[model samples]
Target: MRVSVKVKPGSKKGPLVETDEDGSLIVFLRERAVDGAANEALVKTLAKHFETRSANITIESGHSSRLKRVRIEE
Candidate 1:
């Protein structure tokens, strides 16, 4: 499955996930957006949320931006 996500890095409110009215996902990461830390955290968090492994998740776009498109392979 593919999903659109809005990522908030270094957030005190997360790691948390919420769905927007448009059916997109909002993901907050506790890790900072430095040295790819937030990206790694995002993948791990999504894996847990979707009940899958980290390897199953891939960030197809927006690696350096707040908006990301993720592909989850089941």
Candidate 2:
């Protein structure tokens, strides 16, 4: 499955995930957007939510942006 995500890094109300009306996902992480920490957290959180391993999720696009495209391989 491929999903679009909007990441909110260093959020106080975070570690939360939700789906937008456009079918994109919104993810809030407590980690800062530094040293790829936010990306790592995104993968970890998505893995847990999708009931898959982190290795199965790949960032397809928007590596340096808040909006990201992730590929979840089965």
Candidate 3:
């Protein structure tokens, strides 16, 4: 399955993920947009939310952008 995500970087309460009003997912990352920290955090959060392995989640688009398309293997 594929889902849309909008990331909010540099949050105070660690990483958080929620569904957005526009039908996209909202991801809040405590880490700044440096290296791949935020991306990794996103993956972890998604994995836990979907109750799947991190390996099952693949970033299909927007790797370096805030809006991301993630593919999850069921």
Candidate 4:
């Protein structure tokens, strides 16, 4: 399934995930958007949130943007 995510990078209140009323996801991550750290964090974090593996998550777009589209193989 593909989902839209609003990423909060370098957030102190991170490592958290929330869902918006529109059905999109708001992801709070502790990792900063440096050297692709936040992107990597996004994958790993969502994996845990969905009880899936990191390899199962794929960032389809928005590699350097706050909003991203991710594909999760179910």
Give candidate 1's error at residue 33 in angstroms: 0.5
RMSD each, Å: 0.5, 0.6, 1.1, 0.5
- The total of clashing pairs for model 2 equals 0
> Can you tell me which runs of candidate 1 are displaced by over 4 Å?
none
Q: Which pairs of residues collide in model 4?
A: none
What lDDT does model 3 reach? 0.88
TM-score result, candidate 4: 0.98
Candidate 3: Cα lDDT at 46: 89
Residue-level lDDT tens digits of model 2 in 1-74? 88999999999978899999999999999999999999999999999999899999999999999999999998
Candidate 1 achieves a global lDDT of 0.97
Native-referenced Cα lDDT, model 2: 0.96
Better of 1 and 3 by lDDT: 1
- Model 2 pairs in collision: none
**Model 1 lDDT per residue over 1-74, tens place:** 99999999999999999999999999999999999999999999999999999999999999999999999999
Candidate 4 per-residue lDDT over residues 1-74, each given as its tens digit: 99999999999999999999999999999999999999999999999999999999999999999999999997
Task: Give the per-residue Cα lDDT of candidate 4 at 32.
Answer: 95
Worst-scoring 10-residue span by lDDT in model 1: 28-37
